[model samples]
Target chain A: MKRFSLNQATTRHWPLPDLVAGCAEAGVTGAGLWREDVQAYGVERAAALIRDAGMTVTSLCRGGFFQQSGWEEENRRAIDEAATLGAPALVLVSGGLPAGSRDIDAARAHVGEAIGRLVPYALDAGVQLAVEPLHPMFASDRCVVASLRQALDLAAPYPAETVGVVVDTYHLWWDDGVWDQIARAGRERRIACFQVADWVTPLPAGVLLGRGLPGTGCVELRRFREAVDAAGYTGPIEVEVFAEEVWARPGADVLREALAGYRSHVAELPAPVEEDDRAP
Target chain B: MKRFSLNQATTRHWPLPDLVAGCAEAGVTGAGLWREDVQAYGVERAAALIRDAGMTVTSLCRGGFFQQSGWEEENRRAIDEAATLGAPALVLVSGGLPAGSRDIDAARAHVGEAIGRLVPYALDAGVQLAVEPLHPMFASDRCVVASLRQALDLAAPYPAETVGVVVDTYHLWWDDGVWDQIARAGRERRIACFQVADWVTPLPAGVLLGRGLPGTGCVELRRFREAVDAAGYTGPIEVEVFAEEVWARPGADVLREALAGYRSHVAELPAPVEEDDRAP
Candidate 1:
């Protein structure tokens, strides 16, 4: 339960103050936040409120989109905000191919270089730059970094403390190579942030906000949690789902549901009885 | 032009009689057929129409879906249809996780064993089993096989002549590891089918009918063609798009556009000055 964190994305409409208050009442000590929500609330004020409520900002939502113009400044601001919030990591969603362009290799190379450029700034700010590999579906429009291996490889050139990779189950569960990569991410000391979200089908139009809460879909949430645990990751496991239905619910109810899902699907420590549920 | 094969999925509404006549008139010697269309037209009759038109049935649409009930018998029928159509390969889109199941590893393992079971039958029919790895977005609901590497790995245990992989640009384009895997596929003699489809953004609802004709989106079609060619596969380069806009157009007009897209975006011999369109 100590490791359970509710990423604000799971309840997107929850006001920051109310969310912090609700979480504190629920005994949830950690949160992962999105920049849009924080900015609207004033970063410094949000930081103070979170601090006052005794909640830890596990990681900042995003700071990538390197393919866009002015990305460096935008990310630098995000890093500063994360530092202010006392978050350890700033998750990056490296943007996809520039509009009307098709060179994915170049886009990926730029993401690596962009992260390298931010390493010194991140290190100075005491914020880790977490390179998040989005699902391959988002490779064309949202993020070009589409696999954990690619994320790890991008982070390899920089110091582990300054540049790390994110292991988000929703983006990675489909890859058979993810287990090996998660182990590799651990070996390299690059597991900066871990997010849990299930893969649901009939992806909505645009496929942007179709994620399911943990235990609601096909992802092996416990398997991912176990893999990260085996890889020596003892950090907060954030339930960072992005579904419209989740966002539409009362934040407290959604949080309760998320916690239950997390407990039943993710917090089980032992791995022996896993096959029992899968004997089809 | 000689190596160009139009997968019927591109202009899905084009009736078989008109499509074969259209291709023959355009000097297109090959086509990749879909099962639904063939069954509708009568398999033997469609086969005769293709043969009479002097067009080759480059491959069949699909025969996997190992997660479904009666997959073995269904796939056997698909193999027979491919054989009767004189197509040398039967493409398999391995189905996603069984309903209410989250054991992806088991689902993938099942795919391997299922393919192994079909190996003897496939070899007997003299038709290659081409395992097509769908994009990861479809991992939960459409196909569990989500990468070229996984597809090749699944195909590795069987004879390459009987089991090989499909490398479609739309599926493998986002993968940075695809180049190396393409080379590996060639060395391992596993490049069974090479499909071309650009990845358009704002994927349509359900994400199934969102592919673009060559040059219509962000995939490096010529690059994949060159990589596969370097890897020792001189097989037909099939343009296999599935877009609503494409289907709504007149078949001949769409075919002309597809041929032009293939010529400019995919069949280029030299790879110099490749970054012209990306000079952002």
Candidate 2:
């Protein structure tokens, strides 16, 4: 429960002020926020509101889309906003290929180079650039970084504190190689943020908003949590579903369900057996 | 043109006879058949129609859905139909997770065992069981074999002549490791069939029918054809695409467009630089 955090996206329709107050009232000490919401409410005001409510900003939703024109200026602004909000990590959804381009290998190389270019700004802002590997379905038009190995590799050239990877279960649960990659990220000290969401089927058109609340779909959430923990991560587990159905519910109601789902599915880390309990 | 094969699904609305006549008129010597269409038209009749037109069955559209009940009998019948149609390869789209189950690893293991069980039947029928790895987006409900590597691993335990893998560009283009895997498949002599389709986005709901014609989307179709050829696959390149818009068009019109797309994007495989033409 102490580690539970409500990502703003889980209750997207909730006002930032209401969301902050709701999290405080519900005993949630952490909240992952999105840049649009914070900027809409004024970054300074949103920061002060969360700070006043005795809650911490776990992360800032995004800062990458390297394929677009003017990405440099746009990402620099994002880094500034993260610093202003005192968010330690800025999630980077490396955008997909340039329009009409079929050169994915070149696109991936550009993402790595783009992140390298941003490392200095990210370090200066005291914010970690968290490279998120979107699901492979989005490889053509969303994010070219479609696997943890690719994300980790993209971040490898930078200082671990300046560039890291986001471990979001929704985007990664289908991969058989993720467990090993999570371990490697841990060994390299590159896991900046951990998010929880379930993989639901009959994915909606565009497939972006089809994520389910933990325990509501097919992902082995506990196994993922256990794997992240085994990989030496003790960060906040942000519940970050993006389903339209979830957002239509009352924010408070969604928060309660999110907490309940977290308790039932993610909070039950296996207890370490004492040496005395082992067979002789 | 000799290597061009129009998979029946590309012009799904076309009647079996019309599709055969259309392929014959277009100078295509190969046609990939779907089991449902073949069964509906009467397998023997469909075979005779294709054979009488001097066209060969490049491969059968499918034969695997191991997660469902009675899969053994169903797959056996599929193999027998492929044999009757003279399809040397029977492509397998292994079904997804059993209902309400989260054990993807188990589902994948079940696919391997199921293939092993069918190997004897496939060998006896002189048909290679080609495991078709669907894109990972279909990992939950459509197919559990979501990458060429997994399909190859499953095929590794059987004779290459009896077990092989399908190299479909639409399902595999996003994979950074696919080129190497195609080489490995060739080295193992397990390349049974090669399929070409472009990946278009703003994917429609259900996602099964969103594939684009070869030049209509972002996949490097020529690169994939080259990779498979370098991997030693000298087989028909089936232009297999599933799209609602495509199916709604006139069958002959679609076939002509498919042929044009194939010629522009896939059939331009590099010609052999003759020994006599090489610089002395």
Docking class of 2: medium
DockQ-derived CAPRI band for the predicted complex in model 1:
medium
Where does the lowest 10-residue lDDT sum fall in candidate 2 chain A?
A263-272
TM-score of chain A of 1: 0.95
Task: Report candidate 2's fraction of native contacts.
Answer: 0.70
RMSD for each model, in Å, please? 5.2, 3.4
> Can you give the TM-score per candidate against the true fold?
0.95, 0.96
Local distance difference test values of all predictions, in order: 0.92, 0.92
Off by over 4 Å in 1: A269-280, B269-280
Over B1-280, each residue of candidate 1 has an lDDT whose tens digit, in order, gives 9999999999899999999999999999999999999999999999999999989999998899999999999999999999999999999999989989988889999999999999999999999999999998989888999988899899988889999999999998888889999999999998888999999889988999998888889888888998999999999999998989999999999999999999999996555665876697
User: Which run of 10 residues does model 1 chain B get worst, by summed lDDT?
Assistant: B268-277
TM-score of chain B of each: 0.95, 0.96
Query: Candidate 1 — which pairs collide?
Result: none
